[model samples]
Target: MTKALNEFLESNLKELKDNGLYNEINVVEGANGAEITIDGRKMINLSSNNYLGLATNETLKQAAKSAVDSHGVGAGAVRTINGTLDLHVELEETLAKFKGTEAAIAYQSGFNCNMAAISAVMNKHDAILSDELNHASIIDGCRLSKAKIIRVKHSDMDDLRQKAKEAVESGQYNKVMYITDGVFSMDGDVAKLPEIVEIAEEFGLITYVDDAHGSGVMGKGAGTVKHFGLQDKIDFQIGTLSKAIGVVGGYVAGSQQLIDWLKVASRPFLFSTSLAPGDTKAITEAVQMLMDSTELHDKLWENGDYLKEGLKSLGFDIGHSETPITPCIIGDEKTTQQFSKRLMEEGVYAKSIVFPTVPKGTGRVRNMPTAAHTKEMLDEALKVYEKVGKELGVLS
Candidate 1:
């Protein structure tokens, strides 16, 4: 009986190693900024999701330090068990105002926010109409909810309407929800929120958008829902503080009733420890900076455009990207991996995305252009790209 488990594990492990699909985690040795040190060597970083460069901002650092001095290091307990600090309340209020929602609730991480928020609302009686290319968190959340999941083609509004209409007509579900990523991290494409909203209204579907990548990159730094002016229509707006906000946590913004329900009902929020005081303070200051000035956002866009244009000029397939996340599409997985390794050896740190993360044969090297990256830094990265491309015979 025990032999089956050992044989299965050994076979699968050998298969993964033999297929060249096993991942080797790279150690990022310094701060996650535009440039970083890895294995005692400095490299221009294009793998981070810090779109606004807020992760390393001086103002945010100072705010976090100050909060630590005042509020100590940890919350010490779960939110329902005396972990909800004053700073947590303040951060929720700020998030509500920022997202233009009546209320908001924070969680330990964006992944947990999805896990908590999705299961809190939907159950076996409910059905979820999710985008096929939605994030892994959304998929896990849907699984956790035990809701019947109907996958619509990526960004296909007509397909979404069809599924929503069919699910509602059946009358088997207590509620129908439509969930999507406001900005898909892999493809860097914006979701069709306006069309989705119209369909959701027609079918009475609960609308949910995970704007993890869109926050601080779209709508002048608010998000894709705000970009499309659908704040009043979408029921749940899920976002992360770890990325553009430059801190650590996640939040769900919606009506006061929804937030109130999540406060007591969401398992992650009730069971997990609240965000630390320092993280809360840093995120709040980052949000304030985003609201007060568009300098970083504008610079991020400029840098994105410059990198995209440069890569395109060098005859690389940079896929259908509308945001700062650019993908240099190299079809074969081994080739793409080799290309990325070459880039790393040349002092540019961009990882490769192969099968499973993206469609098979659509392997790519994803690049993120942050505001902290100077033009010279980008230029140098491009030169490395050129050299690597030439060496690998990927470019003429």
Candidate 2:
């Protein structure tokens, strides 16, 4: 490597470490369920996004194995070539039905779905009004489109309306689009989709919602779009199969014309290899399970409520979460990281969120209670939380 490149990387990494912004990844010894083993120790894991706990579901694992036996492991090529298998088509069809859309197209990952779909439809002449708290993938996707991005105040409808009116009246662009997350992951607040949709309609703006964190956890496992009964109104519904679905890949569900356009014009779909046969089969089975019963969904909410109440009873600032996601707020970044560390030492694994990821001085240890967590496991985790919080002077 060049001397300048090496020095640049080393200096940035040192800065990240000095500022407590560096991430240290942990390894799970076995399946990632309600509890995970790390470094020969077992802990109740509260840091995962496996909402319905389908990541380690036996049924989904069997489906994947069966697909591997019959179809092999890899996709072999990009979708436009020979990678579009019958399973991929079936997965897309099932996803469309689940999301209540006319058609759907799949990508290698949720990040890719955004990058591909956004750049495919939007152009330099377009302006995109995006939520300030939208995911990083959405920001990158907008950048790739070369569109004029206007950051609207997060979840503030009045601000969105004003910005949309200004951008539309300016006549500085051929088209305008509004994009946001169906559920804000950090704060666990559900977006005001109805209001956003109304605003978009008034301004003749295209609508896009990334429901990555809401699928399989809202609307009886349908999604936030279906949660608000605006399935037909939103122009684009993007979701991931990796989180609640417990598999891998991402997709966009919309009208047939939009899906066809993405299929042909999306660079990721045209150039990147399609999802593996095993992942496609597993994701299809997972979605079918979600459609078949609400058992997992209900259990997940039950656990979430139980955990939230436990944290609040202990006098921890759990934050205002509309969904199952819980955050134990700690005022300072160092103290927040220390709290998480002590919790892990006491047999609970909750990660800390600090600057850049969240606003300064609002550092929190985010918890995700899943359907697979038993009452006993949650109780134990609560006990650990109480112990750690008290030790850290976060509780009385």
Candidate 3:
């Protein structure tokens, strides 16, 4: 390695360590579920995004194993070069039906889906009006599109309308697109998509909603757009199979024309190898299960409510979460991290968010309660929370 490059990297890493911004990754042994084992200790897990508890579902695992036995483990090449197996086609078709869209296209990952879809339709001649609180992937995808990006206030419909009106009236670009997360992950707040759709219609702007978190948690697992009954009104419906479906992949559901264009133009789908057959089959089975019933979805919400109410009764500031995600807010960064550390030591595993991930001085420990978590598990976690909170002076 070059000496200059080594020095630059060392300096940056030193700064991160000095500032307490360095992340220490914990190794989880065994499958991720309602509980997990880390470093030879079992802990009540609250850091996962497995909303419906399907990640280790017996049905999904069986489907994956069956597919692996028949089709092997990998897709040999990119979709355009014959890697597009019948499994892929079936997965996309299932996704479209589940999403109530005309058609859909799948990608290797959620991040890849955002990068591929945004750049496929947007270019330098276009402008994208993005929510200030949109996910990092959406931000990166917009940047990669080479489009002029304008930030609208978070979930502020009036601001979006004004900016959209100006962009349209000014005629500074060929097209203007508005994009936002269907559910803001950090705060667990659902987007004001109805008002947004109304504004998009009046302004003739393209609409995009990244429903990664909302897909398995909202609208009986149909998602935020369907929750608002505006599926046909939105131009792009992006979702992930990893979070709630308990598998791995992402997709964009839209008009047939849009799916067709993405298939031909999206670089990741065109050049990168397709999703493995096992993953594809597993995702298909998961989506089918989601469509078949709302049992898992309801259980997830029940657990969320149980946790939220438990924390609230204990006088902890849980923030304004409208979903299963729970945030125990602690102002200072170091204190918040310390609280999280203490929780882990006491047999709970919740991660702290500070600074760049969330605003400085507004740090928090986020909890994700899933359908798989038993009442006994949540009660035990709560008892630990109470003990830790009192010791830290977070609760009286």
Error of 3 at 169 (Å): 0.8
Q: In model 2, how large is the Cα lDDT of residue 352?
A: 93
Give the clash count for model 1. Answer: 0
In order, candidate lDDTs are: 0.92, 0.93, 0.93
lDDT of 2 by residue, 71-132 (tens): 99998999998999999999999999999999999899999999999999999999999999
TM-score of each: 0.97, 0.98, 0.98
lDDT of 1 by residue, 299-338 (tens): 9999999999999999999989999999999888888888
Q: What is the C-alpha RMSD of each candidate to the true structure, in Å?
A: 1.5, 1.0, 1.0
Candidate 2 achieves a global lDDT of 0.93
Ten contiguous residues with the weakest lDDT in model 3: 15-24
For model 1, give the 10-residue run with minimal summed lDDT: 15-24
Between prediction 1 and prediction 3, the one with superior lDDT is: 3
